[model samples]
Every structure is written in structure tokens, then in C-alpha cells.
Target: MGGSGDLDAQLRAAMFAHLARVSAAHPDGVPSDVINSFRFADAPMRLIVQPGIRKPAQLDAALTIRTTWTPPGAAAPYADEVGPDGSLRYKWRGTDPNHPDNRALREAMRRQAPLAYFYPVARGVYQAIYPVYLVDEDQSAHEFGVDLGQYPNDEDDSAETPLDRRYTRRLTLQRLHQVLFRPKVLRAYESRCALCRLRHAPLLDAAHILPDHHPHGEPVVPNGLAMCKIHHAAYDADIIGIRPDRVVEVRQDILTEIDGPMLRHGLQEMHGAKMFLPRSGRDHPDPERLEERYVQFRAA
Candidate 1:
């Protein structure tokens, strides 16, 4: 039993390391082919199972849980909600709580084991969140409570007060929003910077036309712009702004600044250039939101 347990630990570590490398290479999301290609010591081992919950034959605990992406205005088959305490409320595989898959997940929670969570970012691609701990289960809801932002050592679940739980919930929701928002925005713009048309995915970001804290600031593709790091910083800092007409405008101070080639070509040369928009008109930056953001840039 000890030898088996040790091997399981080693295998889990290797799987995580492999996933980390894959994720680093594909920051947007991992393709289904790459996910299906994962192997352990020349043996077949799938990282994500079709049935949602995966309990590998070699391990006693559940290896992974997945949630498929649902289109807007469509009802999801298995709705994964956020619990009152901010943890993910993942529904059980079936009505039978004692089912093998449920039992495996329960055992994972009992042993405080970490597992991977595959969240869909596209039809056949997923963003993998790892080492997720199943903290508790809700019998009435027929679901397992998952914590995405913290580990067991981060806090004692039993000793947590309501305030602490609320704080955790806020942080978890924020992370969930970011994870879903970035890929969708980048995908809409074809993973290129809107200002300068930089094609490197790692150098790009999803910049919001309206700030997230604003009442109208929603995390939708129409309200986003795919921007490289420098342009994102410039947009946020009012060094550059985009007009409702889709024209780039460098701040007057920056336009006249006598500096290196970076300033001359990167910012000054970009002035009056037309912004590269998403192929789909529906995914274009919201004119209203851009006008609002432009107002701020003008005042700044």
C-alpha cells in the first residue's frame, strides 16, 4: 500500500509538471489533441475524461473534474454554480451519491488531495486549473465544493469565519472572471494587438474598454481589445487612447516627447493609425464603452 501511494504521488507530480509545460507553451488554452496525448511512463492516462469526473485505475482518488462551456442564452447540461462560501459547486455525476465516481471524489476530499480542473475556453480547448482542493460536499445540492484560489495549507476550513469565507468568495469570483475573459477576448481579435498588430500571444492582453468596476463594464468580447503589453499599459495610463472611429491617438505629451526608437515608432508612429478590429462585427469594441473610456483619456 505504501509503495502504491508513493507511486501515485510521483505520477501526480509528473502529470502536473507536464501540464505546466503545455500550459506555458499554449497560454490561450490547450487543444483537445494535446490534452489527449498526455501519457504516463508509456501508459495511457487521459487528463480529462468525457464523463466529466476521471478516476484513473492507478489512483484511488479522482484525478480531474471538467466543466464544458455553454453558449450565451443556452442552458448548460450540468450547471456548475458558485456556492455561498465562494467555492465551486460541481454537481455529482448522477443522482446516486455512492456511485464510483462520486466515491472517488469523496475520497479525494477526505484525504485532502489536490486535483485538476479543466475549464473550457472554446469548443475543444480548455484552461487547466490545477491542484484544486475539494473542501466539502453538499448532500442536498448533490455537489462537491471546490476551492480554486487556495490550498489546504492556506487556511483551516474548519476554523474559517463568515468574513473569511466572504473574502475568499470575492477573490475566487474575480479569478474566474479573468480566466474566462482573457481567452475569449484574445480569440475574438485573432490573438494580435489591436494597436500595432503584434501577433505573439504571450505579449498580448485583453484590455477592457470600460473598467471592470464600472456599472456598464462587462467582460464581453465587444467590450474588449486585444493589446500587447506596452499598448495595454499606454491605454490604461492615458498615454494613448482609441477614438470611437477606431483611430489610435497618442497623448499630446507622448507625441511630442523626444525619446528613443521605441517612443518614435511604437507610440508616435501609431497616431492616426486605424485600430485592427475583430473579424466579426459583433466582437468589435463597444462604441459606447470606447467613448466613455476616451472621455477619461481626454481628461487625463
Candidate 2:
């Protein structure tokens, strides 16, 4: 009881800390065991907060989760039952659902319900800001990752304008992509710049084929290419380009006027060379997206 109480206090503090950081509209900062930083635009009601092994409830989306209940010694309110999904359904130990403790649990599950899913940034630290409400009960399985909903409480009451909501969502999505997208791209490219073949992680970036502002643009691995810092900048600036067919191209004027080794070896000589690609076909940059962006490069 004491341990659980202490943990609950810690969880509250962490939630507050996360709320403070995200409400300010900043990206996630340093995370500690008590709380995680989230963006203001993140889903408010359907979040995940994990408290390690003892706390077997894992939140995936809003109400989606994998929760566990162990038999208390030998006594239970009823015999174990299985849910429609083949999940086991375990009743609370108490006879009355209205029991104070049970009511408290239900209310907490409703109020604090995961506003956001909290995942580990490190060993003990977890991010927990998305809002979530456990809407169902299932227990047969050990893994539960379910979708709660798009908005915090099935509505967009938080934002006054749809455009404003979109803007905030975009910003928050970018913040999430920073942590989740780049690493996948880096690994997909084996930490090497697709153009220069530079293997330095610090100098590499996950360049998007279609700019994020594009309606069709997505931050999936297939939409990313690993490139060195200079190459990334040049690609973004339309100085260097990749065709949908996977060929590297340099601006004709720059190719003609540049004379240094940096020009010759860096950008010019690479023209017509096949861009390095990921091992998995699924992870390769989308040809359609590349084509769309390549048009802009050609115009430039």
C-alpha cells in the first residue's frame, strides 16, 4: 500500500512536470523518471503512462492498452472470465463495484486516465501526457495496444479553430517526428549519408523527400533519406537533387562554375550517380513523393 501510494504521488508530479513543459509550446526537454515532456498539441485524453513491471497496465493509444490482474492469493469476487477478444477478465477483489477503493480507481481511471501514452526515454523515465480512457475490460492476453480516439474526449473542444488545431497538431507531430522519425531513417540508411556515404551520425540528418508542409508528405521511413549536413542543406535548397529514378543531380550552373575539390567531389562528381538506398524495399524513399519534390528542384 505504501509503495503504491508513493508511486502514485510520483506519477502525479511527473504528469504536472510534463504538463508545464508542453503547455509552454516547447519541444520535449530533459526527461526524468517522474515525468516526460510533451508538446501542447498532443492528444490530451488518450495517453499512455507505464509504471514498470509491477504496474502491468500499458497504454498504447487512448484507451488502448495491455492491462493485467493477478489473482489475489485465493479469493476473488468471482471466477475468472474470458472476454470476447479472448482476453481474460478479472474482477476487482471487492464484492461491490461501488466500494470506495473501487470507485476511486474508476474515477482516477476516468480523470487521470492516460491523457497520453508515456514511453521510456531511458531506463526509468517515461513520457505520459496523452489523454486516454480505458473503455473496456479484457484480460486474456498480455499485449494490448488499442486506439482510444483521435481527440482527447471524442471532440475538439480544446482548439477554437480547425486551422488552429491543425497548426498545433502539426507542430506537435513535428516534435514527435524529431525523436521517432530521424532515428529510424538513420538506422535504415545504416547511419551513412545516401549521397556522400558519410558514416558519421553527428553530421547526418534524416532528410524528407517531400517537405513536411506538403499535404501528402509523411514522416515514415519510406519518406526519409539519410544525408550529410551539407548535402541535406543543398538538397533542401534545390542545389542538389534526387530524381524519382534514384539518380543524383546537381544544379547545372553550380556544376559548371565550381572548381574546388569540395565542388568536384562533393556535389558535381556525384551527378548521375545512383543514390544509396536502404536494404529493405519497404523502407526505400517513395518514388511518387520524390518525383513531386524533384519538380521543385528542377524549377530552382
Candidate 3:
């Protein structure tokens, strides 16, 4: 109770600080509590407040209050993300490399941080990126609906309440970008590289299905091919090509001037192989992306 009292003092200070900053829409005759509550919902705490005092709304003036946003010292980590299938993980975000949030919490931070806060690599996908920040346990969160204890991904036998669409929006955006380049290319190839069977991440590269610089176009994922690096470069230079049905086609131009065991070993040998398949059914490359790239392949 004593601690809560202290929290109220801090919260009150924050609330009034903002109230002092702006003129209330209903300043005239509004009671101090109502004025205070409204201010709490505004600047310095733009909490989406409602009737229940549990959220951003201010509660009974006499009752000790606290914000739900965790600060640097929170027992719970600062960042949390929930997945499409309802998976969740938490992390402490911090700038310092030596801090626990930076070291121990890095993985969770990548998974759970905000879309604005998360670093973006695949254009719009925020699924796997985050900026590190120090853990300050003293801060408050007016967006208090998320119960750190209620985070589901466990055998708690409890169901989540009031489905928060915030997470859903983020994941969908991320998945959409992957659709642009990945699944379509993998599917076009029938899921295996034409040359080597490098079935792992570190080795695979999704190359343009057409020569990178086709007169007809701009780049799109469908214009891609899931080939290993060797094949990717060869395909880009028209040294290697594949028909829409996945049969490999080597350019006669390369055959005469570049006669060698290396070319023969990689390109000529792959003349009749099929394309690689998409990794996940959901990740199958876009047919249009393939079609766009295929046209470039024909011209080259």
C-alpha cells in the first residue's frame, strides 16, 4: 500500500504536468478529479481510457494509482509481442549491449517490440526486428490492458480477453511483404535449386527470374527464382535460363565463347531439372511475380 501510494504521487505529478500544458475542452466548472482524469487521458499519457479505472482512465482520487506501462526496473520485460497463432514472448529493450535486456532479452525483444520500434528489413515486416533500449522500471503505461501475467502461450488453461488487434495488424503487414518475394520464387522453382541442394538459409538466395535489367520492367518477387548463389549469378547473366515449366535452358551464346568444365559442370548439367518448391504452402511465390520475371527470362 505504501508503494502504491508512492506510485500515485508519481502518477499524479505526471497527470497534472500534462493538465498544466493544455486547456481543457470543459475547463469551466469541471471538478478537479474530472479535470485530472481527462488530463490523464490526454498528453503525457495519451491512454485510450474508458469507464473502468483499470485502463488509462483515472480512478477514485483517494485510491492510490499506478500506470501499467512498465519502466526500466519492471519484473516483467518491457517488450511483448503476440503472434497470429497466439504465441508470445517478452523482452527488455535497451541501448546498452551489456544490460540484461540487451544480452538476455535480445531474442524476445526482436519478437515482441512495436512496429514503430522494430527495425524493418523486408520492407513492411516488423515481425523480426527491434531497437534495444535500457530497462527503466520507473515509467508508466496508460495502455494498461495487457496483463503481463495473462500472456498466453503457456498451459495456463485461460483464454485471452478483448482480442487486441494491434498485434494482428503488425504480423499481417510483415507477411504481406514476404509474399512479394519469397513464396512465389520458391514455388516457381518447384522448391529445389537447379544446381546444388543447399537446403538451408545461409546458402540460399532468391534471384531475379529474369535478367535484373529487363527493358520491360521494374522488380517484383514473382520475377524471382530460388537459386543458389552460383546459379543466381549465372541466371542473371543469361548464361542459364529455365522455361516456365521448370526445365533448365542454357544460352547457346555462352556455350561457344565460354566452353569450360565449370560451365559444363553447373549449367549444362542442370538442363532438364525442375524448379524448387515453396518452403511453406502459405509462402508459395506469387504467380504474377514469376510471370513478370519469366518474360524477362524469355527476352534475355
Mind giving the per-residue lDDT tens digits that candidate 1 earns over 1-300? 999788778887887887888877767778867876788888868888777898888889988889977875689999798877666788898889989999999988887777888888877888888878787788888998887755656448668888977888667767777777887888888889999999998889999889888998877788899999999999999999999999999999998899999999899999999999888788899898889899999999
Candidate 2 matches the true fold with a TM-score of 0.51
Alpha-carbon lDDT, every model: 0.85, 0.57, 0.41
Q: What are the runs in model 1 whose C-alpha is more than 4 Å off?
A: 84-86, 153-155, 210-223, 258-260, 280-282
User: Which runs of model 3 end up more than 4 angstroms from their true locations?
Assistant: 1-195, 208-224, 279-282
lDDT of 2 at 267: 86
Kindly indicate the candidate among 1 and 2 with the higher TM-score.
1
Model 1 residue 25 lDDT score: 71
Compared to the true structure, candidate 3 yields what TM-score?
0.37
Model 2 per-residue lDDT tens digits across residues 29-58: 223422323222343332234322112132
Question: Worst ten-residue run, lDDT, model 2?
Answer: 52-61
* Residue-wise C-alpha lDDT for candidate 3, range 19-78, written one tens digit per residue: 433313211112223333433324444322221121223322211111123332445333
Instruction: Indicate whether candidate 2 or candidate 3 has the larger TM-score.
Output: 2
